[model samples]
Structure formats: structure tokens, C-alpha cells
Target: MPSNSGRRRAGADRSPEPRRKPFWRRALRAIFVWGFALALLGAIFLGSAVYMTARELPTFADLKSSQNGQMIVVRARDGTELVSLGPSYGRWMPYGQIPQVMKDAMVSVEDRRFRQHFGVDPIGMVRSVMVRVETGRWKQGGSTITQQLARTIFLNNNRTFGRKVREGVLALALESKFSKDQILELYLNKVYFGGGAYGIDAASRKFFGHPAAGLSTPEAAIIAGLVKAPSNYSPTADVKAAIARGEVVLGVMAENGVIDPSEAAAIDLSTVKIAKEGNQNSVRYFTDWALPQLDLLLPETSEPLEVWTTLDVGMQQTATSAVKANVPGGAQGALVSMDRDGAVLAMVGGTDYVNSNYNRATNAVRQPGSAWKLFVYLAALEAGYKPDDKVHDEPVTIEGWSPHNSGGTFAGEIDVRSAFAYSKNTVAASLGNEVGFGTVAAMARRFGITTPITTVPSMVLGTSDVRLIDMTRAFAAVSAGGTSIEPYGIVKVETTGGKLLYQHRSTRGQVLVPPHVAAGITDLLQSAVAIGTGRAAQIGRPVAGKTGTTTSNKDGWFLGFSSGITTGVWMGRDDAKAVPGLQGGRAPAQAFAAFMRYAVKNRPVEKFDTELKLPEWQLEPDDEYMMGNPDDYYYVDENGNMIEPGTADGAARTGPASGPPRYEDGSEGPGTAGAPPPAASEDFLDRATGRGNQPDPGLRAAPRPGTAGPASGQRPPTVTRPPTVTRGQAAPVASRPSAAAGAPN
Candidate 1:
């Protein structure tokens, strides 16, 4: 109510408010709105571009198919074509001619929703992802049939995200352009079948020797199962494995409603008629065996390959003939021969690959019999025992275990040389005791025997089973001048165009056995062949070998070698039954002789370094009472007791009962003069005992077959009685200290 003139005066003093906003805030708001709109437009354009790019890919109708590449040829080291693995094509069939069962199998095993999906299956993808996440590996694959066809026709087989994206786009285009039947037809005709087969038609012909239209349910399932891994499930590679795969396929077919569960269950995969090809020759066995190795040499390859192996067709045939002729009708035999450097020259797995695909030479793990003694002897040598060192050939008990010879007769005290020559079980067991079982096991491993060896007393007698290949390699070590050898078959692999894919170079291990030690062992083995149990293995050259007959004659082995090569011959009933009166020297040794006779026909006669030159004193008899008194020699009379040099009972002093009789008549051989007649001078006894001062002219010590032992100052393990014996029973009566009760039968 103040007067207007007063209010107008007050208002004239106050300032008026502005109407426009500041420039910076308005500019910021407008910029944010415009930026968001541009980003949205860019995203839409990029998505459209991706879709358009995918749409431009080839349509299902325009999909091109190609014949599989040429065959992968396998050759021998001599450039001879041994076998071919590929491009064995058959007449192609149209979708109408193909079997519906085959198509159903493919859909069921590979893609259950082939007719329902547009292209890529989102549910399948999510499930695959979840499975992969759960397992931490890409174990599950979710590609639909269309997707697989797209990938196979246009994309390289690569596991990459980019490849997968392109595959999905192409799959979508394929679904859009073609009907389900047309897409399936393309897939059936373009997929790879194993064993040089290209499609369903080729696979049907290869497996059933018929057109695809006549494939049985089981046959169709087998063929479909091969899509995941053709080489693995091919009937030609493994008929049993292919049948097993078909069973899985049948289960999946039932799960997917492609076939009734009752019908699937009724399918007998074993009864399925698979066409049988002609009997494959022995060389096929070699090729089949080497195929896996070839795969390992070059794991991934797009082009055909040429695998060159170290196989001698002639040698393989020779081995085959030798086994077929010598092995008994029902028994099985395997022979493996390797070069000095462990190149597998020839391998005869069984009598015939057609009769038995079980490659005995490489796959069979059987007890090595006496062949394992090589490692035991090597262990003994390493433990400072000499071949000349004497161990009782009588019954021996170790930790309640008693080992005896097969002959059931023990020769009193015998040298390791004679014991090994005779294959005396008791002596070998005693040797195992001298050297700890652990040391012997280690020595076997060093020689390349991969089989696990236990620290049991019987281990000394080759109780553990061993692969022939591994055992041959172990022997190869001995023959190859003490170098470890890994037996190899494939020498070189190359692409068909002559590009070097792989070339094998001999990988020699450091000299594990000393040259002299090898020489010493070689001498002992030679004696075993020349005059001992391995006499049947005498091939008229300087061949060294050992014959082994297992307990109960269940197995026999003859392992022999020369400077040029080493060959192992194993023979036994596959059922592991006892072969009555079958000893190692009988059939196995004869086979060894026959094989060696041919193996060395073109090669020179190579003699082992049998010259073991030791000090004359080292070759003398190892007698505790006779060590310092070289002039004082005692001999055992008819009784087992030692007698003085001049005693009347000593007049009939005799060597150990184990020596071979020189004459059937009472008259003694020149070397055996019956205790020197007691009146003989000390010089004569020294000469008779192989203890002459300047090394007896008859005993060359180091070079002779008898003087194999420790180098110097090394003592062999002292022979001792077993700590434990059978309860409530006396030892068996024999030539020396009778066998204890409960001895190894």
C-alpha cells in the first residue's frame, strides 16, 4: 500500500534478470546426443556389412566337390613299393542310389537335428561351450550337418575363431539356398572315407564289396562311425575296433529316434558280413606296423606322403620261411633281426599275418626264458665277478626260495663259465644273490629292456615278461660294441613330390658296457655255442649265443649274435602250455643256426674279441686254501672231501664232476690223469691246475674262452647257503648238497 511513486523509485534502483543460457553447457548437451546417434548408426552399418559379406559366400547348390588326393605310398629302404594307403576310388553314386540307412546313421551320429536346424544350432553351441568349460578342453563338437558341409566344402580345416565365424555364415547361406535333401546329398558325396575311399559309395565297396544301396544297418553304422577318425575306425585297420565303434553308433541312433532301441539292441555287429580281402603277405605286416610310426613322424599333412622304411624284403621272407618250416604245427614263433645300429632289418611276427594279426615280434610280451641271463651275467661282471670265478652249481635257497637246474642233477663246484654254458638255474640264482637284485634290475634297464623288473630272487632266471623288440634291442647293445640301440623301422619319410618330411639318424647312446667287458661276455657266449648247451646254434663261424628253456618247458629262446648283426628267436605255444621235452637248444637253436647261416651268407665271418688276456695268476683256481700256496694243490677224490697232494686217496684226485667225459673207457684224457698219480712233482700239479708261472701254454688266460672274469683286485661274491629252508623236511639228495624241500618246481 505504499504509494506507486515510492515503489517506482525503489524498482528504478533494482537491476533486471537475463533471458539467454551460457554457450558451453548447451554445446556439451548437444554434442552428447549427436555422438550417441552416430554410434548407433555405425553399429547398424557394421552388422549389415557382416551379414552381406556372409551372404556372398557360395550357395549349397554351387558347392564344388573334389576327388581325394593320390595314394600315400610306403616303400622299403631299397625303394621298392611295399604298399599303398590311398586313392583307391570306386564308382560314385547319386543320392537316390545311396542307402537310406547310411544317411540315417550319418544324421544320428553326426547331427540329430539335420532336418530341423536353419544352419548353426544355438542350443548345440551353448551346450558345447558349457561342456568345454566344464571339462577345460574342446572335447565336444556342435557343428550341424549344414555347418560341416560348409566347412568341408569351402573352409580349411583349422580350429580358429575366425574360421568358425565364416563357417557359420556359410552354413546359413547353404541352408537358405538348398533343401534338406540336397544338402544331405552334397554331404554324403563329398565326405572323406578311410582306406582311400572317398564317399559312401567307395566306403561301401571297400568294406562290403558292394554298392552303397545294399549296406546293412551294422555296416552302415560302421561306415558312419568312421567320419570322426577314418584311419582309426577303418575296418581294414582294425575290424574289431570298427565293430566296437558301430555299437556306439547304434546307441546314438536309438537315442536320436533314428532307429528303435529294441532294433538297435538286436543288431549283431559281429555277424555283419564284411568282405574279406586276399591274405596279406608278411610285408603288409611291416607296413601296417610302420604306419603308426609314419603318422608320428609327420603328425599333420595335407598332401600324400611316401614313407621309406628299413625293411629288407629278402630278409623278411627268409625269416618267414625259417619260422614256417621249423615251428611245430600248433606252436607260434617270432624272429627279429637288427643291424649293428639297431635298424630293424627283418621281423617275422608269426607264421602268417593272415592267420594271426597279433604281431608277436613287436607286441607279444613273453617270458624271455634263459635269454634274460645275458643281463644277469652282465650284472655279475659289473659287480667284479669273472667268468672263471666258481660258484656252487648245487641247490641254493634264498629267503625261503630254492632254485634248481632242469636236469635235477647238480655238479658240485663249477666255474661261472661252465654254469652259464650249461644254463644251470642254481648257479644263476646264486649269482643273483652275490649281486643284489636291485643292481641286476638296473643293468637290465640300462640295456634298454623297458619291462619293469622286480627285486625278487627268481628275477635272475628271466621270470619277468619282456617284449621281443625290447629284448632284441638289449642284445643289440651287446653286439653293437656296448652302445644302446633303439630299434627303428622307418628310415625316411618324404612327400610324394620329394620334399623331405623326416629322415632318421641313428641315435647312439654312450657306451654302457666296457669294451673289455663286452669282449668277456662274448667269449662266454661263444663257449655256450661251441661246446655247451647251445651247440645246436653252431653256424660254423664265430657265433656267440645262449639257449634258454624256461621252467616246465613252457618257453624256449635262442639269442645269438655276431659282429655284424644280432638275431633273437623265440618259440612256444601261444597258450603258454608246457611242450614236453622242449629245450632251448632243440628247435630255437636250430632256427637260430638256420637264420644265421643265411644272415651271414653275404657278410664276412666276424669274430668277437674272445681274447680275454688276464694275468696268468688270475686264471688259477679260486681256492681259499690254495691262494698263496700255488705249489700246494688239492683235489677231490671219489669222496667229496679234499685230500693232500701225497695222500693215497689223493692218488685219485679228480676235477669237478661237471666236466665233459673225454673217454668212456677208464683211461683218463691227457688233461685228466687222475690226481697226477700222487707221486707227481709240485710242478706237474701247478701245470694241471692251470697255475703255471708264465701263464700256462694251455691257458692263454685273457684270450681263451675260459679266462673271463674281473679285471684285477676284484673278488667274486662268496658262495653261501640259503638262510631259510623248507619247514620240517630235508634237502633233496643229488650230486652236491641235495636240493632243499619246497624248491622251485
Candidate 2:
């Protein structure tokens, strides 16, 4: 028994205590377990984020289509680019067409390890985090080129952890789908540059006036620098800052071994020639007006568009120059010019588009003043009234409102032609009442006045507000041989790939008025410009127009046409405050003339299709009259006493007398009996038309007895009046008058 127990004990002791594991092995096993659990948890998080982001990701087709972006190039009639709406994008350059230097510059500046990373760069992320922690701010971005492309296509600009996870997952997906070169190309073409430019080609053209294929080292560096902060590094925004950023990019390129260090040091970014930026012309008014019409003309699509407009670049420049030169100081002006067929040739919405972009020519509504008389007269003519028909210019009471002439005194019975030519308020009021307010309103609407008319007696005085474009269109109807026209700027719209989207088909010569009625209206407009208030608008051609001045001189307007071109001019304070001596016949008429002079320089002179026969008495008047200015006229009363101009009594006596005044030689003259004709030196028409070299010296003659004139040693009153035909020279008389005859009109 003793022996058996000893052997068992020995066997038990020899059973070799089970080998104990080493500390390093156990530690390694513990690490493997923890690492596996951690990796599983990270996979779950990444998978959940990918699912959430992928649910809203755009399809591959959408991504491919968005590569070119959206752009609208607006070109003038002659193929000159007026403006480009939306972001400017050049033709897409394929990856192979992109220069190797451009690729190096972008890789060096944006993501140096672009080629090495699959999608997310762990080394770059760690380095960026370290830099941020050390600097207490985020200065470097950890996104690889693929990550940036993924974010641009499928993610919003967000800095949250969730967004970062989504961006990383999407980057991986994109990398799996596309090659490195494809990712780089997409990234370069989709990034924004400053000044409304997008894509490397656009940025290259916008900055260096060249394509990405032709980029030099410095130019490439500058464009590549914009990826960091487009606005801050834009050459147009800050050339010095952009150049400094480019220099930094060059340094990065040198460090990456993309370029020789000596060459990088030798490159001078200052020597880079930036393309001249497009002029920010006031033609924006035309483009703005034409853009809204595009939606109505074409189907909705994402393709880039080319809008061929009816704008004439030369005429636009001329219109702009004329408006700028004639617009009064501290006041604003707008001008619009168009063909008889309604093709808009030029438009100037404001004196300076940089200072103010409010389009007065197309948007602003104001009193048309006497220019509104066009509709009134048209209605009258339609009512079977002839230009030679007589209309009383005496004061008339309508609905407790006593309408008086602008001159305050009423001219006695006169032909409708004379009544309109003088712009007699009483005459217009009487005609409005005679023709019926409804008829006048209907007439205005027929001619394209879209604004609501009050139908009150004062409506004839242009008391209603109306847009300048509408009024201009109405007059265009007259110039189109009485045809209705819709004013338009866009002629055709198509894609850059030659796909036709929209094309304007002219509807000109749609007769809106009877030939006789249009002829009568043209006769009146001709008379107004030839011998009436609108004489300042005459350009030594067969031109017709009307002048308009609102109450208190708040708005001035001139609408005229010649050689199939109709133009309208407006001048006033934006606040509707009265400007001292502002009148439609002054600045507005002058601007109209200045613009028309150049507009019709090459066009052949044309006459009205029909002529109105007038009475011999109306054509050859016996009275002699002298107008100091468009606003002032001197007349000798029956008692041989001179009447002061602008007074109510003086305005009443403005027109020709019923009979000729006898002279000392028993020959009839324009003035009272025995009063000689005004001195030939008093060329009021020349001075008003700006044909004379020097400014008017003022009234030089002494005042007649019982009438007051500028006192001795005092500055003479400057005389300004519409052009007048010599007495008995077969004067042309028609219709519409100027109330503020003291003004240049």
C-alpha cells in the first residue's frame, strides 16, 4: 500500500503542471478581441451613415449632366455678347485635353496625395487634425480630390460629424465607380471660380483669356489657387492677393517635385496677362427684360442656352451716350429704341447701371403728360375728326373740375391741328369730353397701354400712371403704319449644340388703325415736331414725335420715330420731386433728337403715306408772333399793348391771330399793326435745337411800352422756343400742345 501511494503521488507530481501562457501572448490575444469588437462597431456606424446618405444621392445620369453646369449667353443682333445670365461656363474640356501642368498645379495645391489615396486619405486627415489641434483652428482641408468631387455632386456644405461620415462613404463609392483621372476631371470642371465663372475652362478664360489646354505655369497656379477660396483669390477681386496665392501654389508644386524649384522661383505671377473682363453695360436692362420671356418661349431644360436678341450694339452705345450726355445733374434718365416691327434695338434703363439698376424705361410708371395726348387724338381721329377740324381751346368745366390751359388763358376757337400743336390743356380736356373717356381709354388700350385708366376727364391730361414701355409700344403701333406691335428683345433661343429652343417670328404690320386715322395721327406728330412743342426733337429729317411734362415738372417724356425706328426718352427724379425747369421738351426732347440723329443717319428719309388737306387760312396765318422760349411767347394785344409770356392771358394769345396785323407799308406782318417782324438775330429755334454754337445771350431787345423786360445792367432773360416757320411760308399745322411752353419743348 505504501509503495502504491508513493507511485501515485510521483505520477501526480510528474503530470507537469500545465504550461502557463507567456504575458506577451495573453496580451496579444486580449488586443485581438478588443480590436475585433471596435472594428465591428465602426463598420456598423459607417454602414448606417452610408445608408442614410445613399438614400438621397443623385443618380449617375444627374451627376453626368451637371458636369457642364447651367449658363445663359445673351448675344446682341450682331453676335456681340451683351451679358451672360447664371454662372459662366466655357466649353467642356475632356480629361486628355487638360494640360499636364494644370493637373499638377491642382494636385499640388488642393490634394498632393490625390493619386495615392483610394478615396479618403488617412494620412492627410491625421495631419490636418494635428495642425488644427496645434493652431486652435481649421486651416487645412483633409478632403482628397475624390472626396471633394463626391461632396460637390452629392453632399451639401456641412461641417458636422455625420456629414463627414457621409462624405467619406460617398467618396469611397465614387472612387469605386470612377478612375482617378475621371475624379480629377470632374473636380476641376465643377468647382466655382469668382466673377460668376465655373469650371477650369471658364476660370482660365475669365482670368487668363485662354483655355485650360494652353495654361502656362503661372496661369495654372493662379487658377488652381482659386479652389481654396474662389472669391478671395480671384484676380478680378484682388490681383495682388491672387498673385500671392499663386506664388504659394508654385511653392507647393516645387515641393511636390511637379516643377523645378529654380523654375518655380523664376516664374513671376505679376507678368501673367489677365483677359479683359466684360463691360458691365447698362444693356443689362434689355437682358433682364428679355430673360423672363425665355421661360414662356422654351420648355424647361438644364442645357446651356444661347439667346439671340434684337439688340443692336451700336445703337445701344449711341443710346447710352445720348442719355448720359443729356440727363440733367442730380436727375435720372432712361431711353428705349425699337424698330417699327417691335424689335428692341437699344434700351438704357438708367444713367449709370452701377449706381442704380431700377429700369425706368421698362418698369417705372409715370404720367405721360402731353405724350398721352396721342391716344386722345387717335380717338378723336377715329371719331371722324379731321386735322383741319375746329376745336375750341376755351376753359371748360367737367364734373366740377375747371380745366384751364397750361398757359392759364384759353386760345379761342382754332383748328384741331393748332389746338394739339400748342398742347392746350383746355383743348385736350374738351376733346376728351367730346370723344368720351371710354373711347379714349379704349384707344390707349388698343395701342398697347396696359395700365388701368381712370376714365376721368383729367385722364386726357395723363393723370393716370403708365409704364414707359407701354407708351413706347403704343407709339410704335403708330409708326408701324397703324399696326399693333408687341415690343420684344429676344429674337431666338437655342442650345450651344445647335438645338433650336425658341425663335421669334415677326408679327409686324398687323393693322391696328385705319390708314386714314394713322395718317391723321402722324400728321399731328409731324406738326408737333416740325413747329410745335416737340420741335426740339427734330433731326433735319422727316421725324414725328410728341413732348410730355407732368404737373409740377416731376416727369418729362419725348416719344418719336423716324425711318421705321421709334424711341422714347424719360427724365425725372426717382422720388417724383419736381426739378426746377425740368420739361419734356427740354432734356427729354434733346435726348430723343440726339439719339435719333445717329439712329437714322444711314436710313433713307421717308414721308407719311397719307397727307391731310387743310384750309388755306390754317396754312397761311396773318398774325406775327414771337416766343421767347418754348415756355415764353410775346404777343401784342388788340390795344397795341405787349402781353407778358407765361401769364394766363399770354397763353390764351399764343396761337396765330384770326386776321393779319397791318404794317406801316400797308403790308401784313406777324405782329400787331405797324410792329415790324422780330429781328432775324433772334434765332430761338436754333438755340433750342442746340444747332447754334453759343448759349442764348437772353432777350436783347427792349420791352415794348406797358410791358416789362429785363432791366438795364441785368442779365437778359434767355429765350427758348420750338422751331417756327417763317410767316406765310406755307407752315405745317397739326395737333397736341405743350402746357409748360416756357421749357425747352
Model 1, residue 36: displacement in angstroms? 23
What TM-score fits each model? 0.65, 0.60
Each model's C-alpha lDDT? Answer: 0.70, 0.74
- Candidate 1 lDDT, 1-745, residue by residue in tens: 7999999999999999887777988898888999889989976875565478567765544554355455678787799887777676566566787788898999998888777788888888898999999999987789998888877677877989999888887787777667788888888877787777777887888788888878888999999999888988888778888999999999999998879999999999988877775436677667667778866778577787888888887677667766666676678888888998878888888887865778888888888777788888887765544555556656668767887654354555555666676676776777776666787888899988887788888898889988878888887888877788888889988887889989898765779866656765776777677656676676657878787777777887888897578898888888899876566776677667666666767777776755422211111111100111111223222322333434544354345323232221123334446311111234543443345233222122223333343333322233343332353544322222111210111
Candidate 2 residue lDDT tens string, 407-466: 354445565666666577776776777668898999998888888899977899899999
Instruction: State residue 185's C-alpha deviation in candidate 1, in Å.
Output: 3.9
* Candidate 1 lowest-lDDT run of ten: 622-631
Clashing pairs in 1: 386-709, 387-708, 611-703, 612-702, 612-703, 613-702, 614-702, 732-739
Residue 270 Cα positional deviation in candidate 1, in Å, after optimal superposition: 9.8
Question: What is the alpha-carbon RMSD of candidate 2 to the true structure?
Answer: 17.0
Misplaced by over 4 Å in model 1 are 1-71, 86-117, 120-144, 147-170, 177-182, 192-196, 209-274, 278-281, 288-301, 324-332, 350-358, 383-386, 507-509, 572-583, 611-745
